[model samples]
Target chain A: MQALVIVAHGSHLNPDSSAPTHAHADTIRSTGAFDEVKTGFWKEEPSLREVLRTVESEEVFVIPLFVSEGYFTEQVIPRELRLDGWDVSAWDSDGLSADTATLVAEDTGQTVHYCGPVGTHEAMTDVLVRRAETVTGDPEVGDGFGLAVVGHGTERNENSAKAIEYHAERVRAMDRFEEVQALYMDEEPEVDDVTEYFESEDVVVVPLFIADGFHTQEDIPEDMGLTDDYRTGYDVPSEVDGHRIWYAGAVGTEGLMADVILERAADAGADIESAIATVREATRKTEADGEPGKTDTDREPRETDTDGETQAAGD
Target chain B: MTDVQATAVDVRDEQVDALLKRLGSNDGPIEFDGLSAATDADGYALSTPESGDHRGLSEAEFRAAATEDGVAPYVTNWHYWEETVGHRGRHRRAFLRRAEAADERSVPARYVDLDSGMETEWGEVVVTATLGENGDRRYEIRHADDVGAAEDELDGYDDPLDARQIATDDDRGRYRPLKSAPTLISGWIFENLGGRDAVETLDVLYPASVANWNLEREDELDVTHWRETAERQTGIYDIIEDLPREAVEWVAEACCVDSQCLKRREWQYDEGDDLAADNGAGAFPCREPCSLVVAAARKWTKLEEEETHTYEFELTPSEKEQVEAIVDAVADGRIDEIREADVYEGANRYRTRFLRAKRFDEDGSLSGTPTDPTDEN
Candidate 1:
């Protein structure tokens, strides 16, 4: 049976960050989709290194529950899991890729699959749009006030801002509001400075964050100079310099977030069969080449195959 | 990196050695900030030498300063010695030793209790104590495990006894510390309670006790003894009610053992292991196998008392279609159909799966034979 491991960047200080992951695990377990659905954390107990030891599934699929693909996804997780390379194909009967099998002969004999971060999924836009509508109280984008997409921009990556801007454009194209603008917390046109740039009389500020943490409570409020509770349609009128501004909870906290994660997991599973086929083909190709010690290297290592099985090295 | 600027650097072996000697002779506590200011005026001065553009002072200069005086140049760097020596050095070492000691100690058992004066229904309690002049007098009650014992033991000694000598004839058989003559001293009880609202309640309790004790003060009576005894009695009463019955017995035995061990100023095997055994194995009731009983009770209580909301959201047409396809495939026992379901809309992509039902019997055998089986001759 396959095991589904949801890895989250849990917090020791805040109990809310892990809530959604736990909720998703509970929902999946209730349906009995997989033999086991466990949660591991980068910060909390049952860390990434110990995740495999805690479970007994023959095949394991790790889904990173992060909002973005960065250091944690690229370096930290790979290092912790002790994965050397990726394969776009399926594994041999020995349950190891040709190369990995030779590198570590005394293996655990279990197939491990790692799924990309859930944030990369397009279904997440639904979650964002829903959060935007909730903030504006408008079913359609053009029916109500302007929408503002708030993102955490850093000096290190320009692409991060581009991704948020792309999502904002999609929301704007729906014609759901009087206007839609992209704003950042760190980079140029900060949340406060950009609030005035909106042409609409009523502004709805939506935080594009995965967790309602320090940024949502302290930094955002301090920057916005807001003291009153802000929600959908409940505007906190700020008379500072004769401008009206309002705010809303983080987009990640929308009610249907768990649904989006479930959808992504299912999508990853759908591609597993093809991924397994690729692995088999790659293995056969390597064997036919007649190269001594040559390993299966044709297939690329993907998070999941078309059939939802993790592909082995060589497709 | 540029080559070590040869012209800008200078070597003055004699001047540096003299400065080192002067620094060593100075017995007063070294102050770096003050010395840095003094040396800043002259780039490489022993005592007020001419200013130069060279890197203020090198390691050799500082070393020379220390040796100038009789004191050994134990410190190679003057700035480092000034910052770390004397009171600051002592304090740093003390803090490190304390941390090391704490790490060596065993991890304490944590317990939750609601008896603390916090308004909340549940709060945590922690207790720690040290032995008195008598080695056996050491007794501690951790609120987590020994709440009951703490209360009962504390209550037993709450009364204010008179400073009376036991009659020699009556005390003949007993071995008492105050056997021949008796002396009296005042005793006070100090209790620390913690919780969400403990601070507020503590404020009220402390002030009221102080005022009440002061009001009762009178001539000819030892006010200190009276106040101490009264406070101890009240504290004992409070703890007695807060602890469980089992805790009471444990505390009594612990107190007796503590008193005996304390008098000798040496640890007894039995007394030392009593606390260890209580904490490690004997304190809490066995919770294995039967722990389900407690869990069920808790769940039932929560279900009856708690309120839950069944929140729902409207799925978009595409979302509905995707969910239906996956659900239908699972229900139809078409694992491949369900596994192939994928939804891609712009950058929003979703993968779905419908679970396959499990078969109970080995080799996929049927539980019951078919009712209508036709045989051909």
Candidate 2:
């Protein structure tokens, strides 16, 4: 059986942090691409340490639904997931090639392919560009709009700003937008002074974040002077300090993310065809049985050593 | 000793088929935990015992339905429960079995309720479990206040994470510092969550109540006594360790009691030195001094630094007892229970207001004696 595990940094304080991950998992599950689709959280239940244990699949693809490859992708996740032979120090030099790197559990023998964070994917450029144009209801955002790709930067990890910068450069290369700039919540050219970084009066700020929580909903908007009260709904193209700002939702919450996750798995050397085929076969067999739950698989009897020790489903 | 031992994976299908065979021959519908299975002329049916309603499936359908995604619910839920409450060198399997009422119940004797519908409480949240059409466990979490409220009358949430919002604040829109505080607002329900999702919902509502309860039941709870917990404090909290031994009991009485927090206080002055205050009667145990208690202790430590003073004040005997009663009422969170019409109740808002009006002077002093010598009043 093939399984997909989507890992995200869930919050103990804010429940919304894990919303996008669960949404994407539901979407992926509906497609029936894998035998099982489960979610793991760094902060919530079914934690990274135990998420793999829940899956009975032999072949598993684990994707990090993060906005960037940084301390989490480099260190915490590997340690928690117990990905054997992962050199934390080799992340930059070795590039941590997702396709070549296969994590096989010492005990479970589950062949796990750990994929890259979805944020750094090439498809994210499309998502960011799409968000910028759609939020303004202007396909011609390239004509006058200045795009600011915002990230929650930290002094702790230099790699945190790489994804935003990469997307900004990609958008700039497209030459669609008048100007594209990388902004951060904590670093210089911060989201607070977003208007200063753009020459165009029409500025579009897109948060390159996985979850639409406190930073995207409250702090960034408050800093941009778009909304005084975070509780009340704010409109797009809100007049902030005499500048027309169209603030899109977090990039991670995009519907296209479900497709991006599948792409990431494929790129990481996951046998997508085999996974899909397994699920399809089971579904087909169930359908052929003239009912949803019926299958034609043969059942072998018990081996009987300690058969009377405990009840079914017991330890 | 190279004995051939077949793994669970190798024997899962056989076990499921064996259980299905037994289910087919049952004299009538047999119920275990929340699951009910029986055979009829058409096929076999597995459903919730409480509802006793389900669409029957053929033998093939029953076997196929038992396993979701090539992983049997029995296996998945077994490993899930074992990892959840059985890890960390703890032994609450018996308690968990009893909680789900799976103890002494076997497959031939009865079918394993993989996702059994059970009702349990974690602090102020009432968790109700039921079975789905396919015999999957579904859970509904709501405030204890809305226990009997109709579904339409209360707001409904499908996402288990929505419990965070409901658990964050009280009915009055005030932030609750304690997640397990009795002030949880009502009128919201997280309906029809899966087994794992239900546990996650409960965790969001009350953090580690289930895990802590399991640890307590296993007698593996690690309780950090007052001195040990306090001595490790730094900065502003370091003063907590300087508090007199007797004052530690006051902190427990004020902060660790059942009326203040839901967790039963297991910590004491030290290992063997017990506090005079009552440890709470909560279903879960408090393993250590919580951050709230530590913060409160810091404030009390500062207050305890003040020297005692004697001031002369003329007050009637009944008035003195009324003053004490007012403090007691507020401390016990029973001020809302006192009605204005109950004039005789010392803590009644109107009665207290009248007392203040009569006793307080222009400077807001009690009976014209300054309420505090340090203050201008």
Candidate 3:
């Protein structure tokens, strides 16, 4: 049996940050695309190496649920997987691209197909479009609202900004927004400056992040003055200067990305029917993995000695 | 209640302009006049009742004199608004009554802009705007009666230098003005931090712990997220690995201060350094809250449930350097070169085990011997 493993940057403080990642994993698992689907994280347990070891299948797929091809993808995740390979000399000064699943597979010596980050996929724009519509209900209604696509752009790399700018352009092309602008928390053309681009009474700022982690949940909304009370991903509409700002869930957490996950898995030769349509057509948004019950780990066998003990996701 | 009773709403200085604009739209842009020094002083008191003899006492002065919370004096900015048409006492009483009748949230009150020229049920009104000590805007309500011996004689010291000197203490980190506001969660109260204690006192720990003045997230983010994010922002790695899991809770239960200045590892002269200087740097349970201490506390819960991999190596400093270089290369994507180049038996072995970073198998082999990779299975 083949397997699929997804890597996410989990949070110790906020349970909601990693909830979407686990939810999407469960969604893909239902499709039975691979022999098994496992989720690993930098912060939370079942660590990456643990995920690789515990998968019953020898052939596995490692998918990064990341926003862009940055440090975590290039350096941290590869190092964690031992993908740069065993021969110490084989690992050199220049690290591999984390998004390049092919290179990671070659170095790790595992029968794994590495997939591109979910954020870089053509299908993600659809997820973002849907996230905006969930808040405004219709594209025409969104036209009266300024769409501020907030991204975490680093001054060190321009690629991160390019990815966000790409989405803003695509969304703008659809003409659903009265005004479309790209803003960053770290870089210039900041989210604070987003208001300058709009004279509209209403603005819908959709955070283009992979999960409901730090930036999406707090920083973006606080900077934009979108809400006083912010949960992990979704927040109710807040009023500022008579302008209504509808805060949406992260684009990465959209169920459509699960199809993107399977597509990436399929591209990497996970023998399963490709459900690309699910990603394209997926509209139902969720703040939870399934329902508000005990986590899968709590019910499923709580990891054996061979595998690390599994705890619940929120913990 | 008498028409002379005073009230306050803890609002952010930035929001005050819009709030003022909203409250005084009927009076046009209010023409402000007040006594406050612009030099070495920064404060803003928006409005006060124009009825009394000493009506010019800034809101800061009133709060300073009345409260036991040790309120800070130097407010960078603030906003105050009072009635012009109706008697100040009756209007405030009516507003409070109306607010209590409708929504009972200490009223993030929305003032109706009664046109100055026209007389409504309330009465004829005039609203004036002025700049405060810190250059923050202030609005005054001056109605039909020209009370208090002309505008210049009372609180109307247009030039800050002309106003009577008011006493202000070392209140830099204190969010004093909003301490007495009926509403618990005001943007100004949360946004303007009086260290960690003030924020944490209201039981908003998550926001306080994660508050980063440098990142501009302090006003908004609670204590919950500070630790999860500290490692990245501070570039201080191994926060969990370096500190033991069991001790994280003890600090919070023990000598934990509200401001969290104690746990901050970003400063060279932090509480950790001042308290217990071990590990070439001390550990948690500092006098103030800091990112390091907070991160450790947050990490403790996960650490307890974690099934971590361990790798022990007693390598020389040079050997360790080589190992880091190799790991960096592997992490950097220079795998083929390292494989083709000189493979030091020690470095290779160390690389294999360390590459696992105490996160992989306990007895996993350094040598790639012919055995099933899924031997565990």
Candidate 4:
């Protein structure tokens, strides 16, 4: 059996933090790729601590829907998920990837193959670039527009800006945009001074954030001179400092994020085929046993072919 | 490909077997919220008592049936969490589960009394349970004010997370520091949610309310009293520890009462020393001093540091009573409830404005008496 558990930083105060997570879950659920798909949150219900108890599947793929590898992805999530054999103290400078992040629990026998965060995924670079073009309504935004990728960076963890830097470097290499620079919220080249670094008059700032919470909604807009009042969903191309500043929503809220999440799961060797097959076999067996065919209401994981009879005689 | 290391555990089959064992030994039928499990001569029979409809299946068929409608897993998993997991707040879970299942009314029971929807109130929100296919339950959550309001009339939301926005503010869009305040806005409904999802939605709506309420029911609510909580403060808030025993009762009366907050005041002056202030009669208990209360107390503590000087303000007996009435009205959060045209009411907006206009000198003061006579305005 297989399951995909997307762990996100949900907020009790700001529901928008968890909105993208729910949207992505719903989108992925419609695809019918895995036997089960569930979301665990840091600040919401079915928390990271007890989310594992709800999953009946043995082979689970846990993905962090974060911007990049940092304190939460490295320490808090691993500790909360109770990745039994993982050495969370070792902060790998190279950052998390599909190959280097798997952890196996010796007690529950549940193999949790940890996947890299969605933001650091190779596909995110394209999503960021597309956001700049889409928000400006110009397909050739790279020709004259100065694109600034904003990341919520802190001096505490340098790795928080790694994903934004990675995307910036990749987009810059494409030579499509006239200027592509990475800006941080807390660190130097701050989002507050976004227009000063760019040579172009029309600048497009896209927040490389997972959700449109405090940073994306209020802070970025205020810092970028889009609005004096703290608010969300600003009208693009607002004149700020004698320049047209086109702001886009957080990159994680993009609908294409469902593809990136699935890609991360597949890259981590989620074995979705086996999970899909297990459900198909369960449905076939139930139908052959003269039980009603599978329905949309049937979401629970079924017993494997070998366990049905053995289960009745176990105790 | 990622490396694989795992041992298989068939949890679903085991859950089915546990239910089977319970079914086999039962005198009649083991009844849960809506469905009933009974053992027959051939194998096992699961039925809805309200509908008088039953279905028989073999042990293997039962295992297969577990995944069909999720009822088998739902019952077994609930039992698993209750028994083997040593789950905390058993009473809370049971109470919430029964409430989610629509209490005594089943799906068919709702069909019989169609207009009389199976509804229950959690804080200010009204939850209505509706029947789905094959004994499945779907819940609708709305503000209690808009209980029977038309569906289209309200902004419908399917995501439970949207409750945060609804509960974040009052009708005037003012941020509600206290979540359970009676000022919840109407005209919104969470269309349909499953049992677990409904409970989860409520958890988002009223953060940790169910868990805390559960802890209270289990006699495991660890309450941190005012003195103990105040003593642990650091920085500027450290002055709160110096507040007198009599003043602590003022803090309780000001912040912890039902008028100020929805949570019942569980904390007292100390464990053995109870305050004279009336404990709030809210359904849920406040286990500790909230941050708002602590912040207010900090400000009050600073104000208490100032030397007291009784300044004389000559006024009639009715005017004195009116001044007392204004303080009482503001403390009880009833300033808005008093009408503007109701001049007879001492705390009425027009009456208060008239009092301010009549009593003050060029500077805003009562009967030309300065608070601090050392400085002239």
- Most TM-score-accurate candidate: 4
Q: On residues A204-273, what C-alpha lDDT tens digit does candidate 1 reach at each position?
A: 6777666566566556655776644323112243433344555655556565555555555555552233
The CAPRI class of candidate 3 is incorrect
DockQ of 4: 0.03
- Candidate 3, residues B102-220, lDDT tens digits: the string is 12311111121111111111111122322333223233333224323354443332221111011011123222111111112211111111211221222121111111321222132
Model 2 superposed RMSD (Cα): 15.1
Looking at model 1, give its docking quality level: incorrect
In the range A1-315, model 4's lDDT, one tens digit per residue, is 688888887654555666788777766766678776778776554566545544556888888888777666766677667787677444344763433367765434578988767888877887787566556555445777888998877554555677778889988999988899999888888999887898888888888888765566667888887777653334567787777888886877765676677777877786554433333232121234333332221111211122111100111
Query: Candidate 3 on A53-157: residue-level lDDT in tens?
Result: 434455778888877665565555666665645232332312222233443443224575656677766566767766765565553346577887877775654
Correct interface contacts retained, every candidate: 0.00, 0.00, 0.00, 0.00
> Over the stretch A155-247, how does candidate 2's per-residue lDDT look in tens digits?
544555777788899999999888999999888989999888888988888898887766677778778887776665576778876788888
Clashes of each: 70, 1, 47, 2
**DockQ of prediction 2:** 0.03
Model 2 in CAPRI terms: which quality? Answer: incorrect
Residue A43 displacement in candidate 3 (angstroms): 1.2
lDDT at B307 for candidate 3? Answer: 58
TM-score of chain A of each: 0.69, 0.80, 0.76, 0.80
Task: Give the higher-DockQ candidate: 3 or 4.
Answer: 4
Kindly give the stretch of ten consecutive residues in candidate 4 chain A with the minimal lDDT sum. A306-315
